[model samples]
Target: MDTWRQIIADDEKSWVLFEHGTCVVLTTPGDDLAAQAVSVLRDSGPVHPGTPAADFGTVPLETTPGWVITSHHPDVLTYVSPEEIAQDGDNTPLAAGLYGRSKRDQDAHSLTVIHVEDNRR
Candidate 1:
């Protein structure tokens, strides 16, 4: 049910993320992050697998411009922005690094894995 559409920049062919029935341009990445943003937008966001027992962190799904990172994965966490934080109402967007329950300051949040197609060849 997550509908999507995109617009490429005239000069650079950059990606502009937009959803169906809305003009809220979520992001304008130079590459496929725009598609990932759309997928996350259609979904609940930060789609995560069950937490691992090792208490580790994983990479974050590259999110849209207005989305935030609230959970941690046990592999490769990434960076998010303030605008994304405010939009998602995430009080603590974890910085890209090691995360787990062992770390008193970081939450053991997890993220869903997303496969991005590399069209650059």
Candidate 2:
């Protein structure tokens, strides 16, 4: 098993790429980033393990201060926050389990918790 350190290495800006080229770029060094990525994946849908790769879509990349995520697979659903959607307008149709109400509710709850925690810090 590759430790997070081994996967992240010494790069300040690193990404953990998935089998289908989905990736999470880490812009800071912290275990929290890994947890956040996993949370996002889990909240989105079922996360298959062991079948593909132990690290597939789960590993955290070394990052600095600002990190970004990118995915290439057509099956990958892009999530935009309500605030962002309001500001920029939703460009994609909500269908095929994308932007479903349940997922949105979960995301909203998670975002609220994160917002509270961040404010406390």
What TM-score would every model get versus the actual structure? Answer: 0.21, 0.24
lDDT of 1 by residue, 1-106 (tens): 0112212123332222222111112333435554454444333322344643323332333433322222232122223334434554553434322222222122
List ranges where model 1 is wrong by over 4 Å: 1-48, 53-75, 94-121
lDDT of 2 by residue, 19-51 (tens): 222224444425565455445544443333442
Pick by lDDT: which candidate is best? 2
Flag regions of model 2 displaced more than 4 Å: 1-11, 32-36, 44-121
Candidate 1 lDDT trough over 10 residues, lowest sum: 1-10
lDDT of each: 0.29, 0.32
Give the candidate number with the greatest TM-score.
Answer: 2
Using alpha carbons, what is the TM-score of model 1? 0.21
